[model samples]
Target: MPRISRSEAEQNQADRAGPEFLEALARGLRVIQSFDRDRRQLSLSDVAKQVDLPRASVRRTLHTLVQLGFAETDGKLFRLTPRVLTLAGAYLLSNPIASILQPAIDRLSAEINASCSTAVLDGDDVVMIVHASPSRILPLSAQVGFRIPAFASSLGRVLLADLDDAGLDAFLARIQPHKLTEQTIVDKKQLWQAILKARADGYSLADQEVEVGFRSISVALKRLDGRTIAALNIGIHTERGTPEMMRQTFLPKLRSLASELQQQLI
Candidate 1:
C-alpha cells in the first residue's frame, strides 16, 4: 500500500467535482476554512495537510489572502484577519432575519437569564445565525457563526425534524456521526427516531450530548406557510436545570420566541 500526497488527494476530489469545478477557487476556499477556532494559526505545511493540498498551492493561496487583507502572517504561521469577518457580515447584511431576531433574542436571553440562539442547517452542521447571552461570561463560547454537528445538538435535531422522509434519509446517509459525549446518539436509526420525536413534540431537549453536564433545548421556527426554516434554542448547564425542568420551564419561552420571529419573517 502506498500513501498518496496531499496534492493527489485534493486533485482526486477536484476530478470528481466535474469539469466546471475551478480547482483554484475551491483550493482557496478550503484553505480559508482550514483555519478554525482550534487551529487559528497554522504553518504552511499544517494548512496543506489539513486541506489536502500541496504546500506550494496553499502558500500561494495564503499569500493572496494576506495581500488582500483577509489573512496575516507572522512570518511563521498564517492567521485570518478581521477582514474575513466581512464575508460573514455580508451574509448577515443580506439576511434580515438576523437583525429582526437579534433584539428580541437579546431580550429573551435577559428575561430567561440564559444563552439563546437561532440556527439554520448548513450541510451536515447547524450554523448559529443569531445569538444572545446574559451580560456575564457564557458557559458555551457560541456566537452567530458557531457550528455544531446536527445529530448531537438540540437545535440541529429540531431543524432536522422539519425534513421530509426522503430528505431525512439522505441526510442520515451522508453523515458519519461519532459520539461527542457518553450520552450522544451515534446510531442513525436512533437519531432518526429522535428527530421524529422532536417533530411529534414540537421541541427537543438534548442532555449532556455535545459537552459534559451541558443541556440544550430547542423549538422549530416555522414560517406563516408552515415551513420550518430555523430553530430557536437555549443552552444551560445541568446544575441550573434538569431535563424535565428544561422541558417545563424553557420550552414554552423558546416556542414564544419562535412564534414572534415567524410573524416577522414573511
Candidate 2:
C-alpha cells in the first residue's frame, strides 16, 4: 500500500462513499476508534465527547456494538470485546502479504535479537500489519495495528518515498509535521529532502526521531511492477549500535528481506 496524504485519503473515502453512504455506520466505526490502549473503557458521555456526537447517538451505537458482541459493558464503562479480534483476524487472513510475512519477520527478529515489523501506509501514518519482537516483549513495543507518524519514522519515510511529486505535495499540504523528539525533522523542506534521499538510497534510517533511545532502519517492499506494497523495518535500542553499523549491517539484511518478501507477493 503506497502512502497517501491525509487529503488524498479523505478524497478516496468520499469517492468510495456515494450518495447512498450510511452515516450511522460511519458514526459507529468512529465510535470504535475512540477506544484505545490508554482509554480502554469509556462511559457513554465519554464516548460522545470523544467522537463529538450526541450522547443519544453514542448510546445507541454502543448498545448496538454490545448486542453484536463487538463490545462489552460492566454496567458503567464500555470496553471492546475479544470478539472484536475477529475483525483483525479476518483482515490478516484475507491479506496474503500479512499472513505470509509473519513467519519470516519472526525469524528475522530472532536472528537479530531485535524487533521487526511490516507496515502499510495509511493517511499520514504507517500501520503495523505484522510485528515480531525478541522474547515477545510488550512494553515499549509496537504491536500489530500500531500506527506511527509517517514523516518521523524510518518505515514511514521508505513508504513516503514511493509517492510521486503530486502525491507528496498533497501529503505535505495535509500533514503539519511536529517534532516528536529532538532529532525529528519537522520542517517541510527538510523532511522532503530526507524523503528524496531515501528514494535515492533505497532505504531510510531514523535515529531517535520517533522516540529517544530508539532507532529503526527500513526498506520498501516493492512489487515486480516497481509499486511499493509495504515497508519492512528493524527496530533496536540506541545502545545496540551506531548509525554506521545500522546502515552497513542491518540495512543489507533489511533490503534482502524486503526483496524476498516482495518476491512472495503477486
Candidate 3:
C-alpha cells in the first residue's frame, strides 16, 4: 500500500468524531441484527454478506466485538452472547421514560392477559424497549430489543403520527412500501391519512400487517412539550377478538394508560 496524505488522514479522523463517528459501530450493530431468530449463528462470510460489508472489515469488527464479549465465535460460526443485553439494557436504564413506566406496563400486561410493548422511534422502525406478556404464549413476536417497520405496525403509527409534515414527507420519500400481509398499507397517501387520524384520536391500530393473524393497538406517550417519547401497544390474537373489540374495548384502556404515562413524564 502507498502512504496517504496527512491532511486526508486528519480529515478522516475528524469525520469519525461527530455524528459520522458511529458509522463503523452502526455497521457492526447491523451485523449483529443480521443474526436473528432465524439466522442465529453465522460465519464471517455470512455476516459480511448480511451487512453488505467487505469481508476484511467485517472480520476485523467481529473480532473486536468478540473480544469485548458482545459476540461469541466457535472457530467457524459466530453468535451473540447474553452479555449483548448490556448494550440495550443501558439504553433502557438511561432513558427515564422506559425506566419509570416498566412497572405500569407489566401491570397492563397482567390485567389485559395480552402482550404489552414499549418502543422508541429508531429511524423508520420502532425499537422495542420493554415488552411484558402473560405466561401463556401469544401469536406475535414481542420481546425486548425487537424492531418493526414504523409504517407497518400500530406501535409504529403512534410514533409516526408525532412527526411533523416535513419529517413525515421525508420518511415517506425513503420507504418502498410493500405488503407484508393482505392488510398492510402500501399507499403513501392512505398512510398519511391514517397517521393524521391517529394524531387526532390519540391511538392507532394495526390489524395484521407484519403478522397475518395478529392485531395491535397503540398510543403515543408524549412529553410536556408535546414530543412523542415512546409508544405503548397491546397485541391481540385476531382469532380471539374482532377489530371492533380492539377499538371499542382496548382502545379506551390504552388511552387511559397512555394519559397516565404522560403525566409521569411531566
Candidate 4:
C-alpha cells in the first residue's frame, strides 16, 4: 500500500463524506490555490509539497491543469496563467445574484460616495463579483475576479456569518489565520467569536486586514428561503468612516438594498 499524505487523506475523507458531485473539482481547486502571487512559479515537488499531495499525483494533476490552459510550465517550473481567471469569471458571469446585485451596488456607491461591491464565498475566500466605486479617483481596483481570504475581509465574514453552525464550524476549521497586519485577528478563537458577533448583528466590519488605512463593512444577501447567496460591502479610507459609523449610517441602507435584491431573487 502507498502512503497517503495529508491532502490525499483529506480528499479521500471528503470523497467518502461529501456528495459525488464535489470531490475531483475540490481537489483540483486545491491544486490551483496552492500557487499564489509569491509562489507564482513552482516545480512538481514544490506543488506536491504545497498542496500535500503525493509527487506522482501532483505531477499528473499539474500536467492536466497545464493542458487545460489553467496552468503553464517551462519544463523546469509551472505557473497559473490568466486562463485561471475563467474559473472565477465564469462563476461571476453566470451567477444570478451578481446580475441582480450589480445595479443596486452601483446605486449604493453613488448614494454613499463610497465603493460598493458584491462577493460570494468560494471555498475559503470571497470572490469579488460586482464592484462600483463612486469616483474613478477613489478607484476600486480589486477587479471582478479578485479573491481574498474569508477570515480577513468584511465581504468574507458577511458571507461566512450566514453559514449554519456546522457549515461555519467547517469553514473556521479550514482557515489558517495569519497576521496580515497589526489589526488582523490571527487567533482562531477570537476570529470565531467575531464571526458569531457578525451573525448576531447581521453585518461585519473588517479593519485594515486587506490593506492598511483601508477598511470595509458588509451585509449578507439571502433568498426568501433564507439561503445566503452573496454579500454587499463598502470600502473606504479609515478617514471616511470608522467601524461605528459604518454600522450606524450605512448598515441599514445595505440591509435595505440586500432585502430589495432578495425580493427580486425569489
Candidate numbers sorted by lDDT from highest down: 1, 2, 3, 4
lDDT of each: 0.88, 0.88, 0.84, 0.83
lDDT tens readout by residue for model 1, 205-240: 899898897899999988898888888889987899
Task: Between candidates 3 and 4, name the one with more favorable lDDT.
Answer: 3
Stretches of model 1 off by over 4 angstroms after superposition: 1-21
Report the alpha-carbon TM-score of model 1 versus the true structure: 0.91
Question: In lDDT terms, how accurate is model 2?
Answer: 0.88
Candidate 1: residue 261 Cα off by (Å): 1.8
- TM-scores, each model vs. reference: 0.91, 0.90, 0.88, 0.79
> Which stretches of model 3 miss by more than 4 angstroms?
1-24
Q: Lowest summed-lDDT stretch of 10 residues in model 2?
A: 1-10
Cα lDDT of model 4 by residue, 143-244, tens digit: 576788889888888888887899988887887888878988888888889889998988998889887888888988889988888888888888888889
lDDT for model 3, please: 0.84
lDDT by residue (tens digit), candidate 2, 1-266: 23323245445776798777766787799999899878999999899899887677788899999999999999999999988888889999999888889999999988888899999998888999999997854425368988899999999999999999999889988898898889999999999999999999999999899989998899999887778999999888888899899999998999888788777787
